[model samples]
Target: MKAIVKSARGKGAELQRVPVPDCGPQEVLIQVKATSICGTDVHIYEWDEWSQSRVNPPYIFGHEFSGIVVEKGNLVQNVEIGDHVSAETHIVCGHCPQCMTGNAHICQNTEIIGVDRDGCFAEYVVLPSENLWKNDPSLPWDEASVQEPMGNAVHTVLAGDVVGKTVAIIGCGPIGLMAAAVAKAAGASRVFAFDLNDYRLELARKMGATDIINSLNADPLHIVKQETGGAGVDVVCEMSGHPAAMNQGFKMVTNGGRISILSLPVRPVEIDVTNDIVFKGITVQGITGRRMFQTWQQTAGLLQSGQVDVKQMITHHFPLEEFDKGFQLMLEGNCGKVILHP
Candidate 1:
C-alpha cells in the first residue's frame, strides 16, 4: 500500500510503501478513494508546537476521507461492505459521562484519527464502525471527503436559530465559507463575512455572504455595525482562531444575540467581559467538533438538497504522490480545500 508517513518529528511527510492495517471486530476496512488536506496537516508539516505536543512520529496523516467499505468486521452490523462512506474523525469512548448523556462529540476521552492514530492518506484505512457514516450514492466521493469539515460548519451555523436574523462569520476559510452558505440556506436575512484575504472574502460572497470586510483595511466592527443600523448582528460565528477576530466576534453580536465559536485558539486569549459580553448581555457558546450523528445528518441533508455547495470550496486536487504540493498550496493560503486521490 502506498501512503504518506510522518516518520519523525520536524521531518517532511514521505510517500512510502506500508502494510494495510487489519480490521478489528468493531472496525471496518475502507479502500481510500479520496482525502483532503487541512490546516492541521500544515501544522504537522511545519512541526509546529501543537504537532510537537500532540502527534507522535511514524504516523499516517489525514482524516477527511470518503471511500468504499471493502470489508466489515463481524461486530460491525450497522454498515456493510461495498457501502460508500465518510466518517467522524473524533473517536469517542461510548462509556463516558458525556456519551451517556448523548453528548458523545465531547467525550472526555477522545482520540482523533489523524493525530492520535493512523489516518486515511493511504490505499486503505481502518475506522471504528460507530464513526462511519453512510453516504448517499448521489454525493460524489470528492464532495463526501469533506464531510468532516462541513460538519464543523453545520455545528457552528446551527448553534442558534439563524432564520431571518443577521449573521456575521469572522473568517472565510473553507469552514467559514461553508458557514456563509449555511447561514443563507438557514434563512439569514443578511450574512456578512470578514477576512484579511481578499480572495477568501470574494469566495465568501459567492457562498452567499451579502457583505465582506477585509479586516486588514477596514474595521469589521464598524462595518458590521453600520450594515445592521448600529445594532450589530443577531448571530456571530467565529471561525478565525486569531485572538483579535475572536474578540471582534463578541463585539459584533447584538444585545441578547448568540455568538458561536468554532475556532480553536492555540493559546490563552484575553476577553473584555465587561464590554463585550456583560454590558451587551450576549450569549457566548464555544463549539468544538461536530455533534456526532446529528451534525452528519444535517450536513448530508444540506448537501443532498443543494443548500450547501462545497464544490467551489474544492479549488485544487492532486494525486496522493503529490501530497507535498497540496500541503504547500494550503500553507500559502492560495487555495480552498485541496482534495487528494489515492
Candidate 2:
C-alpha cells in the first residue's frame, strides 16, 4: 500500500510503498476514501517547532478522513465491515480521572491518531472501534472528512448559550467560518467575524456573519461595541491564535459574557489579568478537541439537518499524489478545507 509518511526529521513528507497494517483485536481497518489536510498536518509537513517537539517521523500522519470499513477485529461489534465512518482523532485513556468523570475530551493521557500513532493518510488505516463515527450514507465523503474539524467549531459555538445573543468570532479560518454558520443556526442575533484575509472574511459572510471585518485596518472592538449599543458582544469565540486577536476578543466581549478560546498560540501571549478578565467578570473557557461523543453527535446533526453547510468551505480536492499542491494552497491561505483522495 502507498502511504504519505514523514520518514525523516526536517521537512516534507514522502509518498512511499509501505506494508499494510494488520488490525488488532480492538481495532478496525478502514479503506480511506477521502481525507482532509489539517493545520496540524501543515506543521508536521513543514517540521515546525511544535511538530519537532511532538511528532516522531517515519509515521503516517493525517486524521481527518471518511472511509469504509474493510475489516474489523473480532471484538468490534458496534461497527462492521462496509460501514461508512470517520473517527475521533483523540484516543483517550479510558481509566484517566477526566475520563472517569465524563470529561474524556481532556483525558490525562490522550494519544491522537496521525500524531501519536499511524493515521489515515493512505489506502488503508486502522483505528480503535471506540473512535469510529458511523457517518450518514447521504453525507458526501468530502463533507464527512471535515467533520472532525467541524466538531471543533460545534463544540466552541455550543459551549455556551448563543440563542438570541450577539456573538463575535475573532478568526475566519475554516473552523471559524463554521462557527459563524453554527452561531447563526443556533439563533445568534448578530454574528461578527474578524480576520485579515479578505477571502476568508468573504467566506465568513456566506457562513452567516452579519458583519465581516478585516482586523488589520478595522477596529473590531469599536464596531462591535457600537453595534451592541456599547455593551459589547454577548459572546466571543477566539479562534485566531494571533496575540492581538486574543486580546481584542477579551475587549469585545461584554462583561459577564463567555469567551471560548480554541486557538493555540505559538508563543506566550500577555493578557491584562485585571482589566481583561478579573474586573470584567467574564467567563473564559479553553476549548480543545471535541467533547468526546457529545460534540460529534452535534456535528453530525448540524450537517445532516442542514443547519451548517460545509460544502462551500471545501475549496480544493486532490489525489494523494498531489498532496504537496494541497499543502501549498493551505500555506497560501487561498483555500479552505483541502480534501485528499487516496
Candidate 3:
C-alpha cells in the first residue's frame, strides 16, 4: 500500500510505499476513497511550532476522510463491511470524567487520529469502529470527507441561540465560512463575516453572510456597529485566532452577548479582561472539537437537509500523488476545502 508519510522531522511529507496495517480486534479497516487536507495537516507539513511540539515523524498523517469498510475486526459489531463512512478524528478514553459527564470531546486523555497515531492518508486506514460515522450514500465523497471540520463549524455557531439575532464571524477560513452558512441556516437575522482575504470574503458571501468586511483596510467593529445600529452583534464566533481578530470580536459583540471561540492563537494574546469581558457582562465560551455524537448527529442532519452547502466550499481536488499541489494551494490561502483521492 502507498501512504503519505511524515518521513522527516523538519518539513514536508512524502508518498511512500508501506505495508498495509492490520485491523485491531476493536478496529475496522477502511478503504480510503477521498480525504481532505486540513489546516492542521498544513501545520504538520510545514513543521510549524504546533507540529514540532506534537507530531513525531514516520507517521501517516491525515484524519478527515470518507471511506468504505473493507474489513472489520471480530469485536466490531455495528459497523460492517461495505459501510460508507467518515470518522470523528478525536478518539477519547471512555472512562474520563468528561466522558462520563457527556463531554467526551474534552476527555483528559484524547488521541487524535492524524496527530497521535497513523492516519488516513493511505490506500487503507484503520479506525475504532466506535468512531465511524455512517454517511448518507447520496453525500458526495468530497463533502463527506469534511464532515469532521463541518462539525467544528456547527458546534461553534450553535453554541448559543442565534435565531433572529445578529451574529459576526471573525474569520473566513473554511471553518469560518461554514459557520457563516450555519448561522444563516439557523436563522441569524444578519451574519457578518470578516477576513483579510477578498477571495475568502467572497466565498463567505456565497456561504450566506449578510455582509463581508475585509479587516485589512476597514474596521470590522465599525462596520458591524453601523450595520447593527450601534448595538453590536448578539453573538460572535471567533475563528481567526489572531490577537487583533480576537480583540475585534470582543469589541463587536453586544453587551451581555455570547462569544464562542474555536480558534487557537499562536502565542499569548493580551486582552483588557476588565473592559472587554467583565464590564461588558459578556458570556464567553471556549470551543474545542465537536461534541461527541451530539454534534455529529446535528452535522448529518444539516448536510442531509441541505441547510448548509459545503459543495461550494471545496475548491480543489487531487490524487494522492499530487498532495504537494494541494498543500501549496492551502499555503497560499487561495483555496477552500481540498480533497485527495487515494
Candidate 4:
C-alpha cells in the first residue's frame, strides 16, 4: 500500500510503499477514496513542537477520509463490506467519567486516530468499527471526507442558540467557512466572517457570511459594532488561534452572548477577565471534537438537506502522490478544503 508517511522528524512527509495492515477482530479494512488535509496534519507535517511531543515518526498520518469497506472482522456488526463510510477520529475510553455521563467527546483517555495511531492517507487503512460513520451513498466522496472537520464547525456554532441572532466567526479557514454556513442554516440573522485573508473571506461570502471583515486591515470590533447597531453579535465562534483575533471576538460578542473557542493556540492568551467575560456576563466554552453521535447526526443532516452545502468551500483536489501540493496550499492558507484521492 502507498501512503503519505511522516518518514522522519523535522519538516515534510514522503510517499512510501508500506505493508498493508492486518484487520483486527474489532476493526474494518477500508479502501480510501478521498481524504482531506487538516491543521493538525500540517502541524505533524512541519514537525512542530506539538507534533514532536505527540506523534512518533514513520507512521501513516491522516484521519479525515471517506472510504469503502473492503473487508470487516467478524465482530464488526455495525458495518459490513461495501459500506461507504467516514469516521469519528477521536477513539475514546468508554469507561471514563466524561464518557459515562455522555460527554465522551471530552473523554479523559482519548486517542486521536491520525496523531496517536496509524490513519487514513493511503490506498487502504484500518480503523475500529465503532468509529465508522456510514455515509449516505449519494454524498460525493470529497464531501463525505470533509464531514469530520465540518463536524467541528457544527459543534462550535451550535453549542448554543443562533436562531434569529447575530454571529461572528473569527476565522475563515475551512472549518471557519463551514461555521459561517452552519450559522446561516441554523437561522442566524447575520453572520460576520473575519479573517486576514481576502480569498477566504470571499469563500465565506459564498458560504453565507452576511458580511466579511479583513481583520488585518480593518477594525473588526468597530465594524461589527456598526453593523449590529452597537449591540454586538449574539454569538462568537473563535476559530482563529491568533490572540488578537480571539480577543477581538470577545469584544465583538454582545453581553449575555456565547463564545466558543475551537482553535488551539500555541501559547496561553491573555484575556481581560473583568471586561470581556464576567462584567459582560458572557458564556465562554472551549470546544473540542464533535459531540459523539449527536453532532454527527446534525452534520449529516445539514449536508444531506442542502441547508449547508460545502461545494463552494471544497476548493482543491490532488492524487495521493501529490500530497505535497495539497499541504503547500493549506500552509499558504490560500485554499479552502483540499482533498486527496487514493
Give the runs in model 2 whose Cα sits over 4 Å from its true position: none
Give TM per candidate.
0.97, 0.98, 0.98, 0.99
Give lDDT for model 1: 0.91
lDDT of 3 by residue, 1-342 (tens): 989999989899999999999989999999999999988899899998889989988899999999999999999998879999999999999998999999999999999999999999999999999999999888889999999999999999999999999999998889998999999999999999999999999999999999999998898878987898999999999998899899988988899999999997768889888998999999999998999899999999999999999999899999999999999998888998899999
Residue pairs whose backbone atoms clash in candidate 1: none
Clashes of each: 0, 0, 0, 0
Question: Lowest lDDT 10-mer window, candidate 3?
Answer: 264-273
**Candidate 3 segments exceeding 4 Å error:** none
- The alpha-carbon lDDT assigned to residue 291 of candidate 2 equals 96
lDDT (Cα, tens digit) per residue for candidate 1, span 1-342: 999999898958999999999999999999999998877777888888788989998999898999999998898899988999999999998999999999998899999988899999999999999899999977899999999998899999998899999999998888899999999999999999999988888889888999999999999988987888999999999988899998888888999999998887778889999988999899999887899799999999999999889898889999999999998887777788899999
* Candidate numbers, best lDDT first, in rank order: 4, 3, 2, 1
Predicted candidate 4 versus true structure: per-residue lDDT over 23-79, tens digit per residue:
999999999999999999998998887888889988999999999999999888999
lDDT of 3: 0.93
Off by over 4 Å in 4: none
Clashes of 3: 0
